[model samples]
Target: MMNRFICIPLCLFLLSVCNPKKNERPNGWYYITDRVEDSISLEPIVTINDFEEIKLDSAENLKGKFIYQITGHVAADCVEKWADATEHSIGKRIGFVFQDEVICTPCINCRIETGSFAISAQDTDIKSIYWQIVRKIHSR
Candidate 1:
């Protein structure tokens, strides 16, 4: 009886500690931001961890597509943020940032509600860029 009581409380405490707040960013995750700080975008509206998968696919014009699927546990919050940001910043640029670098900047056109999105890659070496992002996220 004594062990059960202690264990239940301990489990509850651990669960609470592991539950990340909606505003918290996972370690080394990339985020979307509208503003740049110290020449780099720092504030996180949504993070890479919110996405289920990020992939690189071939496209026309010698470019590649950086496709993302926002279908994980944080999908609701992630979709909300994305829609809000894009809605507010129509015709303005938003950035994808990791650490101190702005990895990609794309102008918002309209409110995006779809869970999937793709950004065109400027580099021809799409495979390398894809691996680089994967490595960066894992290196955290």
Candidate 2:
């Protein structure tokens, strides 16, 4: 009986020591400028400039039917140039430069995708542009 009691305590101790949970951070992306000034821990993995080429993921069965909503502060110079060049409004246009080219990939529970859009304005200097990409999940 005494041996059985000791064994139970030892097994419990060993089980506790053997299994540990992992430290998981939030899953998402953010666009920031001046990595040090932003007080943000996540470093920017990608950078974009005017007229740069960006690639987006493609979705299956939902191709060309998804809606993208983009919102961010654009540099004043970019607004002026876009106003003169395109019919898109600088104040409300999202995915203006990279429209119709985003690609979606199958994720664990849903699809994940990302794309970069260019802002063109000769005189505007934008400090940072924050954007998010969300896809409509279809029930299977």
TM-score of each: 0.52, 0.24
Pairs clashing within candidate 2: 56-103, 57-103, 57-104, 58-103, 58-104, 77-124, 78-121
- The weakest ten consecutive residues by lDDT in model 1 span 65-74
**Candidate 1 similarity to native, TM-score:** 0.52
Tens-digit per-residue lDDT, 1-91, candidate 1:
9999999999999999999654333322233443453433345656665654566664344345354321222256587776776787778
CA-lDDT, candidates in order: 0.56, 0.30
Q: lDDT (0-100) at residue 54 of candidate 1?
A: 66
What are the per-residue Cα lDDT tens digits for candidate 2 across 9-99? 9999999999875433232222222347432224222212321232233233455543322222223434443333222222222222112
| Candidate 2 accuracy as lDDT | 0.30
**For model 2, what is the alpha-carbon lDDT of residue 13?**
93
Error of 2 at 109 (Å): 26
lDDT for 96 in candidate 1 is: 57
